[model samples]
Target: MTITHTKAMRKDNTLLAITHLSQLLHYVTGFGGFIVPLILWLASKNDVEGMDEHGKSIINFQLSMLLYILISIPAILLFGLGILSLIFVGILGFVLPIVNAVKAANGEAPSQFLTIRFIG
Candidate 1:
């Protein structure tokens, strides 16, 4: 009886781990396309513990999208200035997410500026 129980527990744990990995897999496998929570829902329907790294990475990924949108506004101010401004922000956006994705894949929490807001 004890041996069977232990095996079942291990199976459950493995299932949970796979689920967590799948949630954050977007950071590793794509151009931040799976950065949204919708993709992470494969593992847990409610929430999964010990996966803050993935959440932080996705948050940073979303912030990069915001940077792209913001730069487009300034890019409209002047043709050359807009192009230069976008190029700068766009580069930062690309680099930051890639770094964060690596950190996330390694199960490390990374700090991303302005991405996490204190609601309380």
Candidate 2:
């Protein structure tokens, strides 16, 4: 590939990886889970090809996870099952983003399971 092509590919890969990994913002900002990814995706989606799709996926997954957490709150009254669901959600939230980030770095599309399509 030409140097220009390589550079562009590198940029795309970086942006895609950021899109996936930005979810970690939740740990720092308490609500950065959606905000950080949304900002990154919005800022880079047009500049980097495929970023729009990846951004949408990330945002949708975050939203879905939030919904799941909200639902789990009520389940807490039912023998504390909500606690288990929250734990599972926490694990998935931490793991899936890393997995997707790796996929992005490898120049593959980010595919998230248990995501709801809120933006698209």
Q: Which candidate is the best by lDDT?
A: 2
10 residues in a row with least lDDT, candidate 2? 2-11
lDDT of 1 by residue, 19-93 (tens): 334434444666534444435533443345434444444545565556665867767777578777666665655
For candidate 1, the lDDT comes to: 0.48
| TM-scores, all models, native as reference | 0.48, 0.86
Model 1 CA deviation exceeding 4 Å by range? 1-37, 41-48, 114-120
lDDT of each: 0.48, 0.86
Q: Whose TM-score is greatest here?
A: 2
Off by over 4 Å in 2: 1-11
Clashing pairs in 2: none
Question: What lDDT tens digits, residue by residue, belong to model 2 across residues 37-82?
Answer: 8888888776787888889889889989999999999999999999
Candidate 1: residue 6 lDDT (0-100): 27
TM-score of model 1 vs. true structure:
0.48
